[model samples]
Every structure is written in C-alpha cells, then in structure tokens.
Target: MKKLFLITITLLTTLTINAQKVYSTDQSYKADVKVYVVDQEYQADLLVFKVNADYKAKGNEGKWFFTDAEYKAVKKIYFTDAAYKADLKVFFVDSEYKSGWKDKSKQHFMY
Candidate 1:
C-alpha cells in the first residue's frame, strides 16, 4: 500500500513540474516575467528551449503564445534589441534538461 501511494505521488509531482504554459505579454508592467534576448549565448541568464508543441514543452522547455493583451498572458516578455537594455537575458538551448536559468535569481520568472 505504501509503495502504491508513493508511486502515485511521484507521478503527480512529475506531471505538475513538467507542465509549462507561457504567454508573452504586450506590456512589460503587466507581465509576470520580463525577458531580454542576449546577443551571445555566454551572456544569457537563462537557456531556453522552445518546443514546437505545448505538450512537447516540459520543465524548463516552453511553448510561448504571444498575446495581444496583458490580462490574457501567463507570463510577459519584452524582447530588447540589446542585452544591456533587457531584464532577463536568455539563450535558446537544444534540450529540455539543458534549458534552465543560469542565474538563480531569475529562476522564478519561468515557473
């Protein structure tokens, strides 16, 4: 009985953590998170992996839906032309596990 219970809990926890739905907001102030695209991979605070489908995007992997309105967005990001002008700088990674925040301070922005 204990083993079964543990398995159930583990499965539930895995599913919850792996699920990620992100929305890019039009306005920065109304956004849950702000992001900047860095010119070089070494300068990024987070390494992002954009999956083709929402289901394929898990954990740090994200499938972003850009919304016209602030209220409709789950997370808001303003892409700055320069890294110095942005808040959180990110680099696009190739895999999910490799996709994570290099700067621990910026970690909460994604979740």
Candidate 2:
C-alpha cells in the first residue's frame, strides 16, 4: 500500500514539472531576434521558441523568458521574415539597449 501511494505522488510530480515548460526562450541553431519598442517598453522575441522551448526549456528557466504567441511565431519564421536576415548565434542582451552588434570572429564568452 505504501509503495502504491508513493508511485502516485511521483507521477503527479512529473506531470506538474512537464506542464510548466511552455514559457522559455532558447535555441541552439541560428535565428532572428527582434528588437522593438512596445508602448515605449523595449522587448525582444526569438524567431524560434515553441519547439525550442519544449525541447530545451528543461534547463533554461530564468535563462530566458517566453510567451505563447512567440512559440506560434517560430512555426512561421520563414514566411514572415523572407527578406529578414539573422545573426549567427542567439543573443540575449541585458535590459539596456545597444545598437552595435558583436563580432563572430572575437570570443564573446569566457568560462
């Protein structure tokens, strides 16, 4: 009886963990990120999210923020950005806005 009770609790915990994963933004491949002012508020949205969030959000919490609409946008990036070009890697800049882009030739990260 105790074993069965424990199993039930375990299953419920797993389900809870999986359900909260719809909100995250991260990707391994190249894609465009948008920068715009919404009602004077700055924001950025990834071109790839729904699938990427689901697959990669497992460990990406706090690393990125996401919304359901951005997830849907990922599915149509190609058609929406036909003439838009994207950078090589994904960049999540700080809240402060900057115009110049980083060079791929230089090491932007250091461990």
lDDT of each: 0.65, 0.32
* Runs of candidate 2 exceeding 4 Å displacement: 21-111
Q: What's the TM for model 1? A: 0.61
| Alpha-carbon lDDT of model 1 | 0.65
Residue runs of model 1 more than 4 Å from their true location after superposition: 1-18, 61-74, 81-85, 94-98
- After aligning candidate 2 to the native by TM-score, how far in Å is the CA of 55 from where it should be? 19
Q: How do the predictions measure up, each by TM-score? A: 0.61, 0.22
Model 2: what TM-score? Answer: 0.22
lDDT of 2 at 33: 33
For 1-111, candidate 2 gives per-residue lDDT tens digits of 999999999987664443323322344232233222222212222221222344443322213224365443222111123213332233344432232224323112200
**Cα lDDT of model 2 overall?**
0.32
